[model samples]
Target: MAAASAGRLDPVDGRRTSGARGERVAAPAAPARPAAVRVRPGADEDLRPEAEAALRRLVGRDDAVLRDDQWTAIHALVAEQRRALVVQRTGWGKSAVYFVATSLLRARGSGPTIIISPLLALMRDQIAAAGRAGVRAATINSANVTEWDQIHEQISNGDIDVLLCSPERLNNPGFRDEVLPRLAADAGLVVIDEAHCVSDWGHDFRPDYRRIRTLLAELPEGIPVLATTATANARVTQDVAEQLEITGEGAGRSEVLVLRGGLDRESLHLNVLRLGDQPTRVAWLLEALRSTEGSGIVYCLTVSVAEQVAAQLKAAGLPVAAYTGRTDPTERESLEADLKANRVKALVATSALGMGFDKPDLGFVVHLGAPSSPIAYYQQVGRAGRGVDSALVVLLPGEEDQRIWEYFGSLAFPREDQVRATLDALSRGGTQSAQALETQVDLTRSRLEMMLKVLDVDGAVKRVKGGWEATGQGWTYEADRYARVEQARLAEQRTMLDYESTDGCRMAFLRRTLDDPDLRPDERCGRCDNCGGSTLPAAPTTEHVAQARKAMDVPGVVVEPRSMWPTGMATLGIDLKGKISPAEKTEPGRAVARLDGLGWSQPLRELFASTTPDGEVPVHLRRAAAQVLDAWDGLQVDGVVCVRSTTRPVLVEHLARGLAKYLDKPFVGFVGPLGGHEAPPRHDVNSAMRLAGVAQRLGLDLTPAASAGLAGRSILLVDDRVASGWTLAVAGRLLRQAGAGAVLPFVLAQQ
Candidate 1:
């Protein structure tokens, strides 16, 4: 039904007219019912025409019409002065609603709008969109730190209409302590883009987003707040609404209007193809790129895989680029512009390119491996078919998907002991830097900082000028909630597996998973491969397969040496500091593959998977190790020595013996740990902490035979895995001190 016929205003010819004008005049109703006289809210009626003009101007359309829900949301925010949450699907004009509302409110002499956006790409696009409507939008993000002063000046002078910022900025010491209060006091409207991120139940829960609750509470009453997201499930929606509700004077009294629309995207043709192995998947992707229609994205699970695929395609004479979190900011901008202009076949990317990237006529989206959740998949695929009639969406599920999922899942909320330890370290109420805290805690720097953010949101820790300090507040670790969320994530993984194998409509399955209002479970999309008979070919040509195999089989990844000694070594009773001497330092080394990579990772993982007892190295891995040696480009070592492992002693010895036999070099006896002590230290901390533990608990005693054979000879230091590179560093120093000419470190994999 047309929105106008559904008893709402119509936006036609840049004007909004009420539906009440067409009602027929009737005599006064019988006295059985009390005679009621209704009058339209004069405030909204006065601004409706201006809002329509703003919408028309923003979209560059003369006949633009705000749907029933869009107009309703704008009216509630601008006219009723209430909080609202719009949970519509992508490409549904969620931005238009907020921009129109900003225009309407600013026209009435209100303060500038404050939009808490999540991604820089989204902020850039929004600033441009607002400019078209003459909103004078300016963004303050990490990229444009130099312009913040001018932007703040504009805000103070009432020259800027809208200000965009990341949620992380809300907790920044300078912004929070000095700037936020003033902005909150005079803000006209607050828009939280990607508000689902605020809830732990959300698929992408960010601790920084939880700070929005404090921002909401600080806003003056009658400021009118708006939160918007397209990927929220029922649980996420309820949680976000509760968090977004106005809490002080009008707390819990006025309900937050949540407008949730359907999740079905008629323009997307969803499909899945199960491939046999990595080589086959790569070959199929190469062929698909050659045969596909227009510019699109090819999503991968890891940065290594994305780079590998891009290299393969470029080798096949295709213009492609690899984009991940490691890509430089300026390069990322160039890549986005290239993709927009169709300068490349496709961009092989990770989840970094998932949300808020706009390409109207994007032709397709293909996933080398499925995301762990259906919601994430839906959001990624929604990037395509936004302004086109039809676009292809395919998922090629790999056997390695589950491993990647588990790797990321391990980064969820910290364990109770870890959380408690952080609190205990900060209990003195004095500011301590992250490096100082590392001496007392066992968590890595990245993990510790993440936990601190969560603690800050829970009001147990506060980030001040120098660093962070405990607030002496009571905080409970919600074990049950974390457990439930973990279970939900696992269930989502299983659902994604089911989705790949389902015989029903793919779109319907996605909609049902999101709990869409108009889902028809029994209906087939008639556009997907299963229902439309357009399934991908089962195999690729022999030539393409050979090319893919060659690409995947190329081994040897660089293992850069550690340059500086870890900080706070004195606290660990070690005399190490600053730079390691050139005589003691190990040169750049080589590894067979990354433990998370695709090529030979499976067998390496299996070999290293055992923890109780070690086994002899397998024959194939031995051959691969020999291949790594042959492919190395640097000076050859004189002999081989193993870094003794208590848990994998047999495996390390077997590997060292086999490599010595293969290379026809002297087999130096093992550099075993002193005093029959076994195993490296517990590796649950940062580099400094790990080095401290290793130095205290582990030492190499040069056996008589090894000492006699090692003089002025380069030794190959072999270990099971390279994590943090501290083991290699310390062991290499010992070898150098023992009169070894040069030390070359080699590992099975770099985790």
Candidate 2:
């Protein structure tokens, strides 16, 4: 929903009708008071009636009344002015609690409520919902920079009742140093949606959410705060609650009301289908989605998988769209609207579409691959069956799921040495961008930025306009705590595996994993497949399986050559900067498949496993490489040259020889490392560092015969894999500088 224009509250009925969508919805008239009346400050009378009227207006239904727990949360925020955490299931009116409380608080002449929402989707929904409740709402997020000035003006003029911003915005230099101080001083209430993220133990922990602790600490006493989420277990709940606790006089912890309800959802029917392979799973999904009742989501673990699945489904005459992190923001909104309106069958999505997407009548949710943890699985599945009588939730577990989990696990908090390196870099500087620091540290760009955010939250570093600077504050690594977090994460992964194989009720297992306080040991959700409540469609036809396999078998991903040299290369004694000379640049290249692709992923993963010994290229992969070359219609390669691989030399050599023979081109000698310099470990490092090492260590090792024939000959550069692309780029430049006409890179996989 689009944001409502700033408008004043109606004096007669307290409803804001100006600039809102459609006609103003009217609530049922109260007997001795106005419809949707607000409670006056210090009024000893009960506030339930007024709250009920407000709920009616907010939901646009005269029959809408506050649930007992909703009323309890509202009362605590508006009347008692206490901190509260509402751990209710999705669709339990969590948003209503905050919206109604905003209404009540604004009616009592308090300042506008500041909502620290997590996603742009959530902010849009909250703004639309607030407008329905006669509360004027405006947002300040990355998507609406032009509107921030106006929104701030409206807030100062008391024209808006609720202000929504993302958690990341809270620590932004401008927002933190300017807007937040006033909001903290005069805000009526602060709402932290998806509060579980504030805890490191949560499934989707974000360092940005930790900034909320500083905001909470800055708020004055009696400025009621509310934290809400649907996926927190006992541990996450306690962690978030402790963060919500304010320090009283003498540094004592203040009281925080904790409201946690049962997590069981009767409308959800959970099941797991262990399809033996990716092709079979795709076939099953294709068949299942065809007969599903209503529109829903098909979740994949990676963007590539989501896109591939969506393409497969669409090719089979299904109306579907792929939604992933790489999707454009405008396209995301349009796709979401399409899904909500049932214009499409289902959205093949990654976890990017996980939280804050509201579609009440979603009929089913199918997982193409299992999420890493049960908590994450529960959170994603909770998106379905929210406002419907029943929704089918199925998990198609894959063997590749564990590998994806381990890949993400590798991105956890950096070791003490890495953290200290980052701090040391910042310590010598006025302000150093993450890119500049990357030249000094071994961490990747994303990991370095994440560490910077965590340090900013911990007060060891401060983010400024240009970059970040040290705060001169001493910090510790908290080794024991981080280790425990890692152990907990592993335990969660094991529990998720157990979830797939458990013979008991699926819903009950999820509840137990989440530590549902109201769960009974003997409880079983009769709606699950194990309870004989419902069964999925019959197995997919053999024809369908064959079609899926054929579709996925077509594999070739374009490996775009890197055009610009990475910044700060000069710091490593390299003079290269800005864009590479087009004359020396490699043409667009091809990889047999992505390391995460659906068809070739399994074989590629096995081949690249650390424990696997380097050997000849397997016959199947050799044929796959031939297929890639055969599909390269316009290629004109005179020879093949291999980049020496420190780890997989045999495999790389075999791949190069096979490609050279397939192309019927002369086998050019390898581009081996310099004698006195060992190849650097390029994994997990930034592009600059990777390139620096590659440029310094690698040199052309062609024989004098090959060198004499190299001029004006196109070379097919072969490597086992291309990760940072720096290795390929540097090798291609060397070939071009060696008088090769054009260098075309061909890799086994793109990592």
Candidate 3:
């Protein structure tokens, strides 16, 4: 039986008045069921034979049996035309419920089931699974742009039983204006996968998911909608359930049929192996992966970390590769296939590897560090032990975890000023692409796009063919709501810390965190390292530790040049636009290390701190900088030019002069900051404005002696740090025009 709502977590205001996210509404009373939607007490057996057969086909097995609640959901959606929300564990047959419903509805001559899937991997897996059940499915995503025309034709001709799309596509101008109306009119069933994302209270809320409310409101009444998710607390569930409740005739103020099942995973063996440093933690991972059985995933918290871990593992002769948001789409697909087929030992990945990756018999999941929330951790570790008897799930918490969390927190909600600026810019716009809008607004391209999406959902802006324009509709940024969301996030982080330190049953802890009412914290699973004994070694051997430390300490990262100028620079009143001329481009440069990497970052952070006294280069960093120069591919530099740092002028100048003296080259004067130049704002603004700002501020007013010394001579450009690389590029252009032969850029760090 489904569990009843056990109230909510707590109110941010210390009162029961406001619900989750400080929403000023009560727990929505369960909506009355329509009379025609009633099912008898023994109606679980009423699922049609064809539906059961379709279920078996969906799982690719003859003995697959439908869970009672799964049957209940299928019957409700297929027969009674009622909306439902399925909140079950990851491996629970949520997809089966939707697929069976789609098959039954299509067999009865309904239009194609339109599923709003979250990821391309999820959609790919779902399409394959649907094909196993003899269902023809096609997807329209960025990856499949060329096939969209054929897919749309199939939808129009009723050749497709199902259509899958990403949430972001709902806001695409062409899709929203031309195709969505017809599809909404004809869509038989609307299935929302990973539906927890619809609520801001959820861990991975995307503003685009909010667009579904409009889709729901516009859908003809009585068209059944299904929202499914594996990770949700009572607040998220209640929030999503309220959103799923459609309004119209036959709706009758009814609530979604929320079927939240048990979240316990018997196949998982959880453990925490606390090690002292990054090297020690990495060593533990290498040893554990060797001892563990079958191919699995090693999860890292950041892209750089993932790459570092993957490199360390590969050096130890473990077959591994890194996967993150920056991975190419085609390469991501290939990596997924390789993992499914056990071609590699593990894919060291970020959160991008989670959600909808189905590798049955996968052996283990190891974390280089702990996620900030237990819900997110559970979702990731759940990827393991799916089709196996037992899978090892271990976390190696690092000291840097909290710092990473705070960095991500900064990106949560844009400042009110940024939002207003975006709205104001759009008020006079015919249409402004995100790049064009960046010139008028002070936010980065990615962040501006994110804000615009939220605005689109709020009805303050509308995306058109060329770009986005103001709708002139009034919109409010709920300060309390955002504050409550932040509070909830902090609470989640605290809970995660508790989970790491807790001595109780690990499975019970995860289940309770998900608001599973039946969970007993005292009940021991006799599986986790806390309940049972740990199977991992204490630490890596001394020799292995030394080797790992040496490998990780290897420095020097390549800084790729900016090949193309930022689009819409002309709109910003700059003459520069389009591709940067090849003659002006500098080859990929070198940095001592990335500002976020494990090797030199700690000391670099101390050096770059605002409170630290700025002066000449530190002796230790000077050695490292010399090593970078020595490692460079013998570029014959005739002069050393420094990019003046307003913040780190002394450091930049010292490094440049020292390098020039060491190489026995002339010290080309530093590029000085011109008047009317303000440093780029603390926040990440667009590339065009960043370049424009740098172009206006930095100038190379060379003396006659310096110009005579630089004519036809190669220049080695130096900077304390390289962010956006605009300053270096602009400086390089000036140096080349001043008769320098070649400009090879170098920086102390890349951030």
Candidate 4:
């Protein structure tokens, strides 16, 4: 999967990749096919000798394919000693980490390495790579037309030491019955690739991931699992650690290694352009394709759109190709070949062309449209310049994308009752594939797909290769995946609609959520409008403290420059009565306004300006907010405090623990309706919920809500938003009437 750094990526200054940045990179010389492999634990050790010998013979003859950090990461993983989740980005030799572990382990003939890859494509690629490296490698997938005997023979005889399989294959009864017994009886190691799929909270959710923990329950106690992904925030890493049963003294850790420092490829330019007209956007896109010249991917929101765009480009005489889930498997195969061979100059695709889709010569990655999440954006664009000279990662959008998304969202979205009904059927009928939907529901395949996704969020049904199957959990996902896409659309729309669009740094808007305490903004490489020769006039940062300038007869707040808490939810801070973007309208004051709208009495209305303008936030307030809120409700919380919990543990653990902690100490817990104006539904929870329960065993006495002396305790009410204080009002009243102290309400920095 990796190649040596040669003339592959010609340096900008006629040098090597080792310049000021000391960038390390190599294009993939070996190609891969997406084939699945399934292996159960307990495979015989006798079969591994050949692979071990092959690996031992190769190690000294060939230099290690991985980097120092990569080996450290893999070593930590194999030893089950990693402290944090390691996020190995593109071109960082991630694959080599696992491969090296395989090679070394096989040399000692430790056991079969059971790698769970997200796609067959990546597995085939790895198998091919391992085979080429002299390690015995193969796959297990439904697509494997080989007889079950052939599959079993490889494992029973220990002929295959490295096995590649998808979560689907692992979850199959046939695999557990026919294949697992052999593995359980033999020595094996578990590998989880694209590990982020374990998080439905992540931008990419594969239902099979949820059951990985259950699937491996009976595998092996010390069986080491190497879970790898290009991007994993703290949350996803924790979820994986928990699901994989990772422990301090075992083969997994409590945290992800979070490899954040990588070559940023500043050589590559990032740009976003908004063209209002579809035809104009199309014209500009094709124009860029013809003139900009490089292998690139054009991502559309849908399969049909990708197909259409490819058609238009092909008609225009560009060497264009298209890929979608609907693409015939044979055609998909041919297209990948064409793309790698440089026969095709460009590929228009949906999100289907998954991980390890390296086409290094990709001169530019033109996001013909916006994707649903930053994760998706990172994945799609990260594909560019893997081992080639740096290239442009561009986002060309327009009002049309919003129309497309909203139209689809409005239509693609299924009713909650419809989802509930589907779950009811699944519970009654057991697992049902796409083909069986007609018997269970009257919805068409496409509609069923939307509903199935709704069910996925609701945690009611699981989506497998075949179709929707019910899980015991109720449908709870309301985090709209489509929201990010359309929200991006509308937020951009809001910018364009208001005159403020002309003066702000668009990059600031794009990366507002992204910050590195280690880095600062520079106007030259400014990559933002304020410093560059951009057409848009630079607006003051969201919390600029300069003199007010009147525009459209409205006065700027003209507030002194005041620095916000370094550790608050967002980078931007705005004050009350200040003109703001729609995005920032739901901050503290906005929440207060909403509460006022709901007929609540306000004890305080104004906040004083901080004396140290634009300095570290006053230690008193910052410490108080973070110290209490960090472990809010006795949970480990970090990052921008979301309006509500996104992952289940956030709600089940953090929310409950925090509330319990507060209630035990008589702190106020505020609950209310939260709006997804910025993000769309990822799951279908209509509102966020936080509950508390404590046992005497834990030295806590948080009893039933009707406990005595509850009303005398001091409480501070907190919620992400406050349009309706139904949760706070009800819970607060209940707690008070049950007997505690005064409740003081506080909201985070709201606009």
Candidate 5:
């Protein structure tokens, strides 16, 4: 899924010699059960003419042949005529299935193999690897190439074997004009790597992934869609089939095969450690980094956490690297290389660390904190085993993770308003570019795709060859009903994780997640903290420490670090006071505020006292505003804001107060668009707003449409996560006609 690696979309090297990502996982040792499976009978056949020509174009060996399962999978992988499912695991050589299959197609015939992979690195690596194998695989991404012509030639011409692209790229002319017309009736396949992303039930929900369904719809029925990934449960499998329309009917051929080689690297000790304190856990992790054999991955819950942990790892004298969305493309690539080459022993990261990190033999996968579900836990920890050896997972979680998961995980679904707003926003201008849509949606891009796919299913929008367009229809009763039903199926998975956490059956629970139903109830096997009892198995709990009083920059008032437990008066608006920041322990009472609406919001300001801690209030601003400064930094965090919309006028008023300065105009009446609170509870923007303050205070009064200014001023649109931002988008447009030159809107985060 590399957006650029050499091996990804590697050129169709006629030989099925090298595996994907330098893998050693043997192609599922010839299938056990008999289905009269037939392999292409060509023990002594000459290479396809194209393949032979391709081999001559490169440097290495030729006559690459596929094994039985490899042969079947490859054909399935590259065929322009089948809908297939590949349920292979990490060590099962799944990548080879795609790489070889696509190559074979190009060798035997013509046309490009369009691969939709998960990571940019994976794509680059695939291209690099193919170049080595004598195949030419090129990746198109936000990096290097900025022009459309280059991509057009790369894919449209008969020369390119693979066009590694993202769903987000389909709208670009490089794809719509150059590759798409050729995709029809082309004798090649559309390989979707990390296919679980296509399913909403997948551990890591991606909105863009859902658009694959539309991509499939456009392709000639003969051109097959091959999906491959290691981490997928039952629900994920079903959702994938349904999304791809891989029905069990004539001419609509498809197969869901699971390569059940449990990714258990016995060489890499698997242990679970539990600590009662937070600092202790962080300290132990620091120790592990210092003592571990090689560079490793430290998984955290968010970008902020990853940054904090990276700092801690750095403070301990370790050459640490960090990877998160906040990291620039160049920095991320450099950091990944440093960690892989062992230049940096520890890399602190969030879910961004999940896919395409091909550094096998890693010291370990340390969970600085717990994840929301078991599937996520498996995928994160499974990062270790690679295609060869085993790996380790250190689930170091304190009471905080449990408390947070209990309160928020169950309700994480997208609200009806969020969904509608999202669809409406995406359907703008009757159609909007992916980039424009991304600006107004709240979920991650991948998750946003899935939402779009669902919207496509509903009739809210249609995924066109170049972008998204409104369809003037609703999702079919069947698809909507299916999504509604799948919601429970997905929630049950969370329920299972919770049950296992409570029951202390971590390994069994994880195995079950991968569809290994035969896994039986067993003892802790004396490997985990639960079985070890008082013994130090591994998980640690670090204490939440407040910034030192000396570090505090407050001039007159003392704002002690908020506790996990509630304090008096509950004026802060949530179930508890704001959680303590990692820097809170080192720089107490400092605060900072960040207003959205780039042009409208005031500049970021750090608040501190007149007296300085050391010099220049440490990082600027006085001690009096230091706490506020830090808090301000926290608010800028992408996913922090919860409520995405306001339904009540009073709630809108509360939002206006919070972002008053962000209100673009000098002084214009606010436009309040009521949010659909009746939507699904988990993702209900209203609920998130309630937690923020909208529900805690009095209502807001809306001015008449005529009274609200139009041409001369600006306005503010406040919502928790900014899903869609279209509930009042029309109203915003109306404001423009009335007088407002710029109707500025602010959402907590965009999709």
Candidate 6:
């Protein structure tokens, strides 16, 4: 549950009178008491009345009272001092239980509650709610680096009643070594918000969350704990509950009070539209937004798609914005505020905007592509209809959604061999940055970092001031467990597909997927497309479809050239480092479209699919390629050189020949691969490894006749696609060294 916004309290009744608009209302003063008296153990008296008073201040409502489940969770924490896991639907007041408990615990002379929140946005909302309740709250997150010293000072002085922090902070070198120990010892209560993240079975699992076990182990016995989430199935709930169990020699094993509620959202009217293609989907989305009641979110499966959809909506005169992981933190805050105030029609966002964004009156949620699992979809859609009586939830399932799911699945736990390699590297090298390790490991930076985090949690490694170091602890590969996880992920994907195609109740299907205890076999929302409730236009108007197609078809993504050589290239036996020389760099280039974009992405995806055989460029894409060259504003080239592709050599050659013919330039021989060396898959390796592989295999193999006029002539560097851009950078450097006056890189798609 998200926090209630700040509001004013009625002085006489201690009830909220008006919305304070996130202003700090002075909390009622507590009677002066000794700190020792406050810290004395569990509450022996009935705390319900006091808890209700705090709840009134929390929600700013005169008649605010806890649900029996919320009261039970609070009672478990305050009176029994037991660990508890609460799995309730969105808007069920989960945050209220913790915040109210914090108020009571603080009043009873306990140390500030420590909340392990996930997102920065959640932290902001939480801190505001704490202030409204007259509880002093502060946060330590990535965004508040400069204020850490002040916040720590506040905590030391007993000025803070609650501390909100991200799970990632638990493993920060200085924080882990310094503040965590003291926090663990002194914290009165520990609350894990969005607790599903603690379990690998969760749709949105984070390795850092596993560190909570160590924190739990260190906390003194009798310190109450609460773990809360809105979207956890029985499996994830059980896993999280088990993790919440505190085991110690003297304390034995503490039981966790599990409180799970139904996953139904009566306010959400669910629907699915099988809009045949990308253009039709976008067109229908445009029409829906125009007719929709209030501002909401349009979730895309990828960042590029969010931006493209947002752009399209804005072009059609809709007030819209894009929110994704790539969005700047400050700008995200601004956009969130815009959405909250109904200043915009919608925020076309990716999952980055998911988890804990608190907009109560949001009217609709539309998915441009279905999430890989029903649990994840439920979580995103939960952001809507929190306060309103009704909200529209629509899913436009795309054919590419499964392929995207597969792409993400590929980034799961690495093989035992890769794990051993990482361990061996750290065991030998005392401390190495992730960038340095990238040269030695064959994994991408993100995948490698994820592995290191998992290893850190497993005690196989430790993150220190400089970087990571091996802990010398014997660690098992757990290959079987990893395989099981992969299998489960595939099953979830299949279930999501089933959800898209199911004729039964959409809500019931999701509840079943989440193992909702209250789900009935014949349960039906009676408000979905399948239930004869609300529905959208069966198909988009031809005019809107034409506009969408036109906007998508006019595509060209700028390919930014690599400015700096990857670090630690020397470790990979390559001497390159620091910035590439300006003269040797390729000019800013262009691609017909991004591999993830809405327009040409379909055909490009098909043409480059793993199952698709290599051949000449398709006629449709050939025309698109010519259009890209024709639209080039100031491009001039005397010759074209193709990068030899180990996988798609024929396609690359054909593309190069076609471009050369279109440009009326000489097809100056290939940047042929070295015979003895084989390059690894580009997507699987980091920049250092990718660059080293390309540098070792590719060279300017111009014949004497082709090389005759190469000097002082511009060259168009051609390739099927660009992933890391390292290949083009290295190939451009080689061509420049061989006396090409200038190199301009071009590709069919930017991957």
Please provide the root mean square deviation of candidate 6 (C-alpha atoms, Å): 6.3
Residue by residue across 1-751, what tens digits does model 1's lDDT show?
Answer: 1233333323322223333212111111111111112225585568677888898888777667676677777887887777887777777678988999999999888899999987787787778889988899999988788999999999999999999998888778899889888998999999999988998887888889988898888777788888888788777877887787665576544567777776666678888888788898899988888888898999999998898789889999999999898888778888988998999889999987758887778889999999999988988898897777678888999888998899889888889998898898889537887877887778888888888988998999998888899999999999999999999999999999999999888888887787665555586678887778355544688888887888888777888988998776787678899999998988788888888777877688777774534788888788788889999987588888888887787888888878888878877866656774565567667888888766665556656877877778998888878989988888888888888999888888988
lDDT of 4 by residue, 1-751 (tens): 1222443322111123432332222211121111112222432233233333333343333222333355345555444423323344555555555665666666666777777777655566566667756668877765575655685687777788777777766556567556765675455566778877887446566656765665555565555556667655444555565565544354432333434333244434556666543445566666676667567778877664576568666876889888888887667768877877878887888777775675556677777666645545655666777655556666766434554555444544455566666677778767766544433444545566645654554456666555557779644635465455345444434443331233454333333222211123641334433435323212223222111111111111111111121121121121122232222112121122211110111111112122322222233333333443433342321111112322222322343334445445433232222343223222222111111110000111234542443444544444333322223333333334444444333342222
lDDT of each: 0.81, 0.84, 0.81, 0.48, 0.51, 0.84
TM-scores for every predicted model: 0.92, 0.93, 0.93, 0.56, 0.63, 0.93
- What digit string (tens of lDDT, one per residue) describes model 2 on residues 245-360? 87766233265777777778778999999888999999999999988899999999999999989998999999999999999878988999999899999999998885788887
Q: Which parts of model 3 are misplaced by more than 4 Å?
A: 1-37, 40-48, 676-683
- For residues 1-751, write the lDDT of model 6, one tens digit per residue: 1112335332212333233221111111221110111222445346878898888888777666566667767877887687888788777678888999899889889898999988788788878888989999999988779999999999999999999998999989999989988987899999999999998988888999989988887888888999989888867877887787777664443667777777777779999988779999999999889888999999999998999999989999999999999998889889988998999999999988866888778899999999998899999898888777789999998988888998899899999999999999999988999998999999999999999999999999999988899999999999998898788888988999999999999889998888776677898889888988766655788998998999999768889999999888987789899999987999999898888879999899999888999899999999999988888899999999998888898999999999999888889988868878655456678888888888888877888987877888899999999999988998999888888899999999998
Candidate 1 off by > 4 Å? 1-45, 533-538, 611-613, 705-712
- Backbone steric clashes in candidate 1, count: 0
Q: Is candidate 1 or candidate 2 better by lDDT?
A: 2
For 622-678, candidate 5 gives per-residue lDDT tens digits of 222323323433233111111233233333344444444332323334433245433
lDDT of 4: 0.48
Better of 1 and 4 by TM-score: 1
Q: Which digits, one per residue and each the tens of the lDDT, describe model 3 over residues 1-751?
A: 3211134211000111111111011122332221224775655555557787887788765545565567778888987788888777777678888899999888888889999987788789888989988999999998888999999999999999999999989999889889998999999999999898999998989999999989998988768888888898888888888887776665573666777677777779999878888887887788877877799998888898898889889989998999998899899999999998999999999998766788767789888878888998999888887677688889989887887888778678888888998899888766888888878888877788888999899999998988899988889988899899999999999999999999888888888888874455577778898898446655789887788788877778899998888887777677787787777777678898887667676678779877998899898888888888888887688888888777777899999999999889988788878866536324276787888787777789667899887777888999988888898899988888777778899888888
> Which RMSD does model 2 reach against the true structure?
7.2
Report, for all candidates in order, the number of backbone clashes: 0, 0, 0, 71, 104, 3
Candidate 3: worst-modelled 10 consecutive residues by lDDT: 9-18
Cα displacement (Å) at residue 237, model 4: 3.2
Return the lDDT, model 6, position 332: 87
